[model samples]
Target: MPRVTFPHVAESYRSFKMLMEDLGNEVILPPRPSKHTLDLGVRYAPEFACFPVKILLGTYLETCPKGVELIVTSGGVGPCRAGHYAQLHKKILHSLGYPVDIVVFEPPRLYPLDFLHNIQRLNPRRMSYRAIYECIRRAWRKLQALDNVEKLTHKVRPRETIRGATTRTYRRVLEWIDRAYSLVEIEEAERSALEELQKVPQDPNRDVLRVGIVGEVYVLLEPASNLEIEEALGNLGVEVERSLFLTGWTRDNTWAETTEGLTVKEAAMPYLPELLGGHGRDSIGNTVLYAKRGFDGVIQLAPFTCIPEIVARTILPRVSEEHNIPVLTFFLDEQTGKAGMTTRLEAFVDLMRRKKAARRPA
Candidate 1:
């Protein structure tokens, strides 16, 4: 099978890769987020599509040869637009003249048994409980560690150098994290990445503006969609913080599910029932958490039609007002541009700088 994988946030890739390898199929990794990717995605995708979805669809077009047999990816189900992504992508790909199997890995929540059965079909070499257990453990640990390191880097001195180093190191580790078959190797990789990142010398004179990014997972993590938000911030001498990174999500939320009785106070359950679905519950908790962290400001990046973020959007103003933090909400669709986003981010950074200066002890 001429298989390919869409790039996602760093931490999720390990578990994704381990599962794929277990299934006895190799996936061609599309290049990481760069100008090249953004251009390709923008050139080929439909006008009204979500940014990340466009990039993913474009990635398949760019990578797959004319005779390729199949493309596979995880898809969601429900009122959320995510559930329809696979079908939309498939239709779009077919219209673009690539009529092949768009094998979707549907959400297990809606079809647990069917999900398992599909996995079994894909990789008949059933994973032993011990093996599955080990992989999950490693993936979680590395993710949490990476999250902690990133958060600390943002608050530290010489923000750009530290942020850049840590990011590069984490990316390197992520690409290789799946190859580890033991806990020790995972631990070693985590330690080595952090140590290398920390060794990047800090500059004393650079004034770093710290800004927080929040919102739907796709727009936040996928660079093709966000126009390299982090890099744009860093270029403007600001340290960018994102609430949707996999490590932070895994640490603040997923840990409770996997480690029974080991709850983290940072992410409390929202009073509102999860109304938007998918990651709705987490967004509620995260909105409150980001407010408490005293970040300069928060930027929410949801797809134009993303319902969960719309719901979160209603709640976030209350969180921001109560905490007195400025919040910028961006609804991104296919038309979002690098220049437009850059201008907005530059303005936000200037606002943060003025706010910080106002409080300086003179």
Candidate 2:
């Protein structure tokens, strides 16, 4: 069995490992993105490649030497450069003298046969159809459990009376979820995790700024890539709600397009009217939805030089003005500094607080 590895794309790696192992392959998990990873990526990746791509390159470089023979990654659609990352990574690795195979799971709508073939390629054991379905089912349950814990953290973090309590509990819950197997274990882990989060003492009457996170999925989901903006905001007494989660993103791209009875395309119709690739359309639409739902502000995070987000950023100001919602856009890259991001977030939170105060009854 070939040893397979996947790029770190958030907490999804835990679930991905379960899927690969169940399929009879040895899964080597990629290292979480860090300074060394970023530096490695920047050193070898193209000068203009986006942050996620660089981080992915860095991850592969770190894992390939560990006897990884195959790389499995998702493909993209529209104008996003992500669609080409798998091929690009393969060439770069081969040019550098590594002989690893990469199998990309392209959009099922565009390349149905290719998608199925790629799945089969990853199944070196040639597991039965029923077995493969069961593996995918269990993996999906785990992914959902992980996403729920993440969302709960956002709600609990800002209100927690004990500083860092939510973050600590969140990490513990993630470890428990990772160790879980089977649908029953996954559900039990999720239930117990949510209960643990609820136990964190919180100031229910405290006024907290409600902020919606919108942007490229990678930066939105990956803490290192976004410099842990959600935790920063929570520490500043802000409640964060993210527009993208791995489960929702996977469902939309693979099976269902509508979320909560509304498609991002429909929501963004008045502003964008078409997919600009990546999560550009979703960013614009979710921002609009946040404003309507009475969120205090919205922060959009994206990789520097990401074209889709650049387009979205240009249009975001208009959305802010028309919807009367504050929107802050951060473009991240290897050079992005945590200190600068923290300062900006603090200022944004202050602005939102003042805005909220002004709207109150005198």
Find the candidate with the highest TM-score and give its number. Answer: 2
Best-fitting candidate, scored by lDDT:
2
| Residue 44 alpha-carbon offset, candidate 2, angstroms | 0.5
The reply for model 2, stretches above 4 Å from the true place, is 249-262
Show the lowest summed lDDT stretch of 10 residues, model 1. 257-266
lDDT of 1 by residue, 30-65 (tens): 555555655766776666666677667666766565
Which ranges of candidate 1 are over 4 A from the true structure? 1-15, 33-46, 66-70, 94-99, 106-110, 124-181, 203-209, 235-237, 247-274, 278-285, 310-319, 360-362
> Residue pairs in steric clash, candidate 2?
none
Provide the global lDDT of candidate 1 against the true structure: 0.63
Error of 2 at 214 (Å): 0.7
Give the TM-score comparing model 2 with the true structure, all chains together.
Answer: 0.95
Candidate models: Cα lDDT each: 0.63, 0.89
RMSD to native, candidate 1:
5.0
